[model samples]
Target: MENGIIYNSNLHFEHQRWKGELAFWKDELKFFNNRLSELVTRWTNKDVLAQLEHYQNEFVLHNEVIEEMLEDIEEHETRIAGQSKTGADALDTQMVKKHLEFRNRLETQRHIYSELKKEFFRFLEKYM
Candidate 1:
């Protein structure tokens, strides 16, 4: 039926969107993890203890966002399974809201990460 075809198309589009989001989150997390590792290797001074602690805390916060992104992907997968059209629509709306929130958090985390990296480099230049 035409209705079935339309529903299938919508479902396919939704899946594609979800896949894009998954890829984006995975890439962001990988970048965050790599940066954290690099920072750890570069931090060699015991005197910069305050900055080190701040970096560690920010790293943990970024990690929590990554975890939340993974959880959101898992929930989306579960919701898509055998879902009705109405349910899927509702889930899509919820997903959009969640995506917006995640994006805002990601932007904030990125800004913090950049600031931390700049400070770390400045500390190195000043002390080392």
Candidate 2:
């Protein structure tokens, strides 16, 4: 999202950068799940564990869907490249549609991740 990860004493800068990426929906879904795992490890509340588990399960499903969409996109692209002018045009339209659908689903997953992160942090604040 930020193009690269940095580590230094510029805490506020780092946070601002991360927040900027989140605001732009540029952060990857996989990274969000990784951060969730890190948060879960620091959590001591058993009640929140179930909710985290649910999020984890949802992430697995999202990952599967993302993978399938990527495969479909690649397949369509290949077909378009190998087809005639007329056929290629049709595949091109279909590819764009699939790309948009995939992006919409990805955005939904990102929103879910954001909500989960907020909830987990709130739980930590309340219980930890």
Scored against the true structure, residue 23 in model 1 reaches a CA lDDT of: 62
Which residue runs of candidate 1 sit more than 4 Å off their true CA positions?
A: 1-46, 81-91
List the global CA lDDT of all models. Answer: 0.57, 0.55
Q: Tens-digit lDDT track for model 2 on 38-122?
A: 7688777776777667767766765665556455545644554565444432333454455457557657766876786686568
Instruction: Give the clashing residue pairs of candidate 1, or none.
Output: none
Clashes of 1: 0
In angstroms, the error of model 1 at 100 is 2.4
Best candidate (score: TM-score): 2
Error of 2 at 81 (Å): 1.2
Candidate 2 — worst ten consecutive residues by lDDT sum? Answer: 1-10
